[model samples]
Target: MRADIDGLPVRELTGLEYASIVEGVSVDGEQSPIMHACGHDVHISALLGATRLLAEHRERWSGTFLALFQPAEERAGGARKMVDDGLDVRIPAPDVAFSQHVMATPAGNVHACLGPSFSTADSIKVTVFGRGGHGSMPHTTVDPAVLASMIVLRLQTVVSRETRPGEFAVVTVGKMTVGSKVNIISDRAELQLNVRTSTSTPGPAC
Candidate 1:
């Protein structure tokens, strides 16, 4: 069994009944509030409970039980990093692996399926260059903010118009960084995009 032990950099809403009161600094040295917005906390708790139960009733199982706790799952490189760091040589490989995720379902219900349940994800960073100048001199500068905005608007068509009906795909421009001040245009803009598709095969839209 495996559990991803990472939290997203999201701030909890005020007056939330179960909101985490703890706050921590990120790797970028920005002090902010952090919470398990993806419910990895539940995953950790569930895996811990299962590990204890399986250990207490070891005679019921015939094979080795490994509880893998992975970090940096939100960044989408935790498993790869573990494998690169000699995870295969460090531990015994299993015949099969099992993992679970918390979904927005009923509290006491469990859902299982045979086929793929999650989509393959990809993160892309795109930078667009421009000439920086004062905001008042619009003609003197090539505004990358406008260019980035156009790209963001056009990327929506990738999922809506370009993708065929019934195909599961998502294109999200999660973050866009442009200028630092209101009166000056920046030299460049960066866009962080997240793409998700059900199949691993390359498609025309995704």
Candidate 2:
């Protein structure tokens, strides 16, 4: 498998020491920036395991098998790049391609679905625009902090009260940052949201 242009940091998975070099001070704590909470390491490990299994059973299968350990899945365009890089032509195009994910579900139970099983996930960023003014004057500014709060709460309604019951929909404002400190009415605010789906309720079609 080819490597990513900017490969994922292995130190994110296995880091021995925290450095205090020229870059910046490294804080020591149980919580570290390099974490496998998203499970990318698990994915790579499983790919290796699958490769070993396929190698061991090489005699059983007759047709050619193309094993790809692709990258940039978080960006949602890695598979397309591999295809554009002649993945299907140089390697004999297989009749079907497959990928598997392990999620927080009922223990000891495995399940699979067909026809657009997972929903397309994407990130949404919203920047609330406002006017800045002195903290003493209450009505002088647009108060983007309040507007950002309204946006977050209103987005939730799009999923719960708006979307169809069977159709799965989610709009979440995961992070919000406004004023740096007290006594300052910030002029702008930013929010980041992560959205997800299943075959029972597919997102808008491309």
Candidate maximizing lDDT: 1
lDDT, candidate 2, 153-177, per-residue tens: 8888877886766677666676798
Runs of candidate 1 with Cα error greater than 4 angstroms are: 14-18, 113-115, 200-206
Model 1, 168-189: lDDT tens digits are 8999999999999999999999
- The CA lDDT at 74 in model 1 is 85
**TM match of model 1 to true structure:** 0.87
Residue pairs whose backbone atoms clash in candidate 1: none
TM-score per candidate: 0.87, 0.68
